[model samples]
Target: MKVCFVGSSGGHLMHLYMLKRFWADKERFWVTFDKEDARSLLGEEKMYSCYFPSNRNIKNLIKNTFVAAKVLKNEKPDVIISSGAAVAVPFFYIGKLLGAKLIYIEVFDRIDKSTLTGKLVYPITDKFIVQWEEQKTVYPKAINLGSIF
Candidate 1:
């Protein structure tokens, strides 16, 4: 199955990387920020860089939406997974619209409260995974996969 992994840099990307073993043998690519850390960690893996300043930038969000739509159309991945900040929003919606299974992993840092991105995409995600049990209260349908760390 072809998988598209999407997430921001830093903790979000790190947590998502922990799942590398699961997708190691599968056909996969990534959608993330273009940063030194992401570059070093991803190595030679296939990746597409999204626009920066995504969290609250309406202009870039709109730009990234189109980018996400195009990528979804071209890649046609069977599944799209993300541990997000804000960049994943467009992909989540577009991926689901394109019939790709959507999986959203709640970031590890937010145990007591739901993340903005999590709340926004929760309804559309096919699978919502949480690292901590407390997060289950926020995302009742979420599967507790323990910490991705």
Candidate 2:
């Protein structure tokens, strides 16, 4: 199976990296911003870099959509999994267009409420995994997969 992982730089990347255990037997690549954390975490793997836009900016979002479209066309993954903070938006959308299964894993930091990315992308996911059960009420379709830590 071919899997593509996407996320932003810090905690999102950390949460996604923990999923390495699940993809150990499959082929995988990554899409993330060029940051110290991403460089360190995904250095040994095939990674595609993109500009991580600020959550409040609209212009950057347009650019991200274009970048994501390119990545989706190029990688052609069977499935795309994300532990997100905004960057997951375009990737998952493009993954859907390519007929890939989309998996959204809510970050571990969100203990009480659902995050902006989690709420936005939840409906589009084939499987939604949350670390906190408290979030299940907000996103009832999500599965409690326990904490990534």
Candidate 3:
């Protein structure tokens, strides 16, 4: 199955990268920022660079949404998975609309409360996973799959 992995840079991307073994054997591509870490880690991988200043940036959000639409249209992945910050928001929404299964993993941080991306994508995601049991209280429908780290 074709998979589209979407996440922001830093910890969000790290969390997703931890699952390399899971997607290693699958046909996959990535949606992330064009940052140093992303470039270094995903050097040989297929990727689509998302816009920066994504969170709360209405302009970039709209721009990235359009870009995400094109990526989704071209990739046509069966599953779209993310450990988010902001970039995943547009991708998840557009992927769902395009009939792709959405899987969202709440980041390893934020044990106290749900993140904005988590709250927004919860209703639409086909599978919602949380690292902490406390997060399950915030996302009752989410499965506690332990830490991705």
lDDT of prediction 3? 0.92
Better of 1 and 2 by lDDT: 1
TM-score of each: 0.97, 0.94, 0.98
Looking at model 3, which ten-residue stretch has the lowest summed lDDT?
Answer: 107-116
Candidate 1 per-residue lDDT, tens place, 63-101, comes to 999999999999999999999989999999999889999
Against the reference, the lDDT scores of all candidates come to 0.93, 0.85, 0.92
Model 2 local distance difference test score: 0.85
lDDT (Cα, tens digit) per residue for candidate 2, span 1-149: 89988888888888777777888788998888898888987778888887756475678777888988988898799999988878788888888988999999887777788888889899899999988889898899999989889
Better of 2 and 3 by lDDT: 3
All candidates: CA RMSD (Å): 0.8, 1.2, 0.7
Better of 1 and 2 by TM-score: 1
Overall local distance difference test of candidate 1:
0.93
RMSD score of candidate 2 (Å): 1.2
Clash count for each candidate, listed in order shown = 0, 0, 0
Candidate 3 residue lDDT tens string, 72-135: 9999999999989889999999998999999999988789798999989999999999989999
